[model samples]
Target chain A: MSGRSRSRQSSSVRISDEQITDLVHKLQQLLPEIRNRHSDKVSAAKVLQETCNYIRSLHREVDDLSERLSELLATSDTAQAAIIRSLLTQ
Target chain B: MANSKSAITLLNSTSSRLCFARTSATFASAPPDQLKRQSRRIKMAAYSSMARVAGRRRAWARALLFRLHTRPRHKTLMRRKRRPSTSSDDMVGKLRRLLPGGETMDVCTLLEETANYIHCLSTQVKVMKAISNHHLSKVN
Candidate 1:
C-alpha cells in the first residue's frame, strides 16, 4: 500500500479480539527471540529462584490446615466422608 | 481504576510489613493458636489484594507482551490489542507499545522486562490462591 493509500485507509485498522489473539500468536512467533537472553542465565535464574521462593511461602497456613485435617481424620474413612459431605453441602 | 496500580503498590508494601510482623510475632508469642490466627490473616490479606492487582496486570501484560513481540517494522502490518478496557494494565501496556523502535533500548529489552514483571505478578496470584484455600480450610 502506498503512503497516500495507507493514510486514507488509516481508520480501517481496527483492533479486535481476533487481533488480540493474532497478536498473541505473532508474539509467540518471536519466542525464539528469547534465544538472545541465554547469556543472561544468571540473572534469569535469580529471578526464577526468587519467584519460586515467593510461591513456596504462599500457602503455609493452607498446607497446615490440610495437614491438620488429615491428622484429625487419622485415616478414618467415616471422618473423611463426613468432611467431604460437609464441604459439598456448603 | 486510575489509582489501581498505586493502590496495589501501597497494599503490596504494607502487606510485606504485616508479613514481617507476623514472622516476628510467631517467635515471640508462647501461644500457638493466637500466633497461627494472626499469621493466617497476614497471608490472606496479602494474597487477596495481590491477586486483584495481578488480575489487572495479566490483562495489561498480555497486550504489552504482544506489542513487544511484534516490533511494528511494517507500519501497515501493526497489530494492536484493544483499548485496554480498564486502567493500570492498559496504561502500562500502552506505554510499552508506544516506545520508539531503532531508538535507545530494543523491543526485546522492554518485552523481557515487562514479561518478568508479569511473571512475578502471576506468582503472587498463585500464593494468594494458596492462602485463600488455607483460610477457608480453617473456617471449616
Candidate 2:
C-alpha cells in the first residue's frame, strides 16, 4: 500500500504499462517508412532540377565549342567530320 | 396527344437538361458583341491570374508526367529526325523573317551559318579525337 500509493501520488499523470507499450510500438513501426517516402520525393525533385541545370550548361558549352571547332576544320579537312565542323561553324 | 406525351416524357426524364438548354438559348439570344466582350474579359482575367500563381516546377512536373506517359519517346524521335532538317531551314527562316522589309540578311545568314557550321565541325573533331584516343589506348 505504501509503495504503490507513494509512486502514484508522486506522479500526477500515470501511464499504464499497456498504454506505454502500444504508443511506443506504433511509433516505431510508422516513423521510418514515413521519413523514407517523404525524403525520396524531395530527393527526386532536387535531383531533377540539378540535372536540368547541368544539361543546359552542357548544351551551351557544346554549341560554343563545336562552333569553334567547325571554324578551325573548315580549311583543313572536307571529310564528313570536317563538313560537320564547317557546317556548324556556318 | 403525341406532342403532350413527348413533352411529359421529356419533363420526367430531363428537367435539368431542359433547364441548361433553356439557359444557354437565352444567353445565345443576347447580343453577340456583348457576350464576346464579357467572355474575352473572363478569359483574360483567368489567364493573368494563372500566370501569376503558376510556378516553374509545376510546368516541369507536367512535362515530366507527359513524357512518362503519352508520346514518351515520340518527341525524342521527332526531335532527332528534325535536327538536320531544321538547322538549315531554321537558319533560312530566322534570316527570312528578320529581313521582312526586302533588305538582304545574307551577310547575317552567312555569318550565323558559318558559326553554326564551325561548332558542328569542332564537335565532330572532338568525337573523332575521343574515338582515336580510345583506339590508341586499346592498341597500347
**Top lDDT hit:** 1
Please list the residue runs of candidate 2 whose C-alpha ends up more than 4 Å from where it truly belongs after superposition. A1-42, A75-90, B1-140
- Model 1 docking category: incorrect
Ten contiguous residues with the weakest lDDT in model 2 chain A: A69-78
- How would you encode candidate 1's per-residue C-alpha lDDT over A34-76 as one tens digit per residue? 3244433424333333332332333343345324432322222
lDDT of 1 by residue, B10-116 (tens): 34543454445344443332355554455444444443444345443333334433443454533312234546455543333343544322123323333433444
Q: Stretches of candidate 1 above 4 Å error?
A: A1-90, B1-18, B21-105
TM-score of each: 0.25, 0.20
lDDT of 2: 0.31
Q: Could you tell me how far off, in angstroms, the CA of residue A55 lies in candidate 1 after the best superposition?
A: 18
Cα deviation of A2, candidate 1, in Å: 44
lDDT minimum window of 10 residues, candidate 1 chain B: B99-108
